[model samples]
Target: MEESEILRRGLDAFAELGYAATTMRELARRLEVSHNFINDRYGSKEKFWRAVVDFALLDVQSELDHRMAVGRDDGERLRNVIVQLYRLSAKASAMNRLMSDESTRDSSRLDYLHQRFIKPFWDSIEPTISSLIAAGRIPDAPTHIWYFAVTGPALALAQDPIADRLNPAASPMAEQDRNGMADALSSLVLQGLLPLSRGDATDRNG
Candidate 1:
């Protein structure tokens, strides 16, 4: 079997039994091969897990690229970007859950996540935000704040649909709540930035 196939089967095992609970033998069984086959391909379970994480992040990157290509103004772009990013959160949350469970008290997985997934995501998107700022689509849009506003609810939205329904009073954000959430975040960004554009400022100060 291909190395990619081996990683795919390993990820399936991780999803089924969780990272900590999943073993190479379980993955080999899923692949219809001996554990030695998996070991020979990936060298160890950690390496296999790392491959799975990389694959999932590539999925996220592909989705993000598509969203960026859809062409929208700043507000609509933010909404679309957030929607796309949040959509991937389901798979990401599963990976995140596995990482946390597998590396309990060891936090190395968290570091791995930042390196393997989060940083690449940030690097890809940050320049887009810069372009938006240069085009007067957003003003003073700090990357951290923008990122937090757009992506903060990813884990909760992916992991807890019922919690969103049960507590609309406090946390009214479900996985399907993308439209409203997008509107709210878009409004916040546009209202903050549009007023600071050159034309708007000239009108105000002239």
Candidate 2:
């Protein structure tokens, strides 16, 4: 099978089983290949894991970059970036799961993922995020808090069972409803979450 297919499947396996539970042979089995295929090709589970991470992140980075480029101004760009990430988190559910799993520990896996993906992703958006901070439009919390607040709902759209149970609609949300939800969520981050910062500014000025 092609390497891309292996990487895609590996992403799902690692996200589901996590690093400690996943085995090279199990991955090969999932691929329907010889049990030792992964070990032979990647030399070890660690190398294969890195390859999978790199492959998934490359695609994410590309999409984010494109979204950033299309914006006409900083505010628009920042909003676009947030919207795109929300879509990606739901669309690339495995990546969201893997991020949540790795973030709970202090392992080299977290370090590797952070150094490779999280930090860089933050760096790209920091200037825009910071501008909002400077303008007193968002909370003055630590960077990591902002990261979590923005991404905490990554699984909300995918919890089909829970959403279906809670939602009163007879059918699933229409595309229009989904789009509206996305917009509302973005507004919550960009506007709703800023009351604290705005209050602080108000106190200082008045």
Candidate 3:
């Protein structure tokens, strides 16, 4: 089988079983190949895991870069970025699951994923966010808080089994539902970030 096909199966296995539970034999079984074939090609499970992450993240970074490039203004850019994230969460649910699971512990794999995928995406968007803040388009809030507010819901939605169990009515499963939720979340985020009126601002400052 092609390496890309192998990596795709590996991604699903890792996402479902996580790193510790996944094995090369299991992956080979999923791929309908001999275990020796997998080991011969990738050499080790760790290398296979790295290859999977690399494959998934390359697509993510490309899509995000394309979406961010299409906006005409900072506000539009921010909205575009948020929409892109929601779309990615829906499409690449496995990637979301894998990252979230890994993030709870401190590991070299987590660091590698952060430096390669997460950091670059954040660095790319930071300028647009800063520009909006500088222009007083958005209220001054900590960067991390803003990120959470924008990303948290969509990420939650990606884990739909948990989300559905928690609240089936609000869980986004269909494309239309996902788009509607993304729109509502984007509006809420933008509204929260809008500059407060002078009286309110002054009152808070005082």
How high is each candidate's TM-score?
0.58, 0.79, 0.80
lDDT of each: 0.63, 0.76, 0.77
Tens-digit per-residue lDDT, 126-165, candidate 3: 8988898898877667878776766676666456776666
Best model number under TM-score: 3
Residue pairs whose backbone atoms clash in candidate 1: none
Candidate 2 collision pairs: none
Shift in Å, residue 92, candidate 1:
6.4
lDDT of 3: 0.77
How displaced is residue 42 in candidate 1, in Å? 1.2
Candidate 3 similarity to native, TM-score: 0.80
| lDDT of model 2, residue 24 | 66
Q: Please report how far candidate 1 places residue 158 from its true position, in Å.
A: 3.4
Q: Model 2 Cα RMSD, Å?
A: 5.8
Give me the runs in candidate 1 sitting further than 4 Å from their true place.
1-6, 15-18, 29-32, 91-93, 99-108, 127-148, 160-206
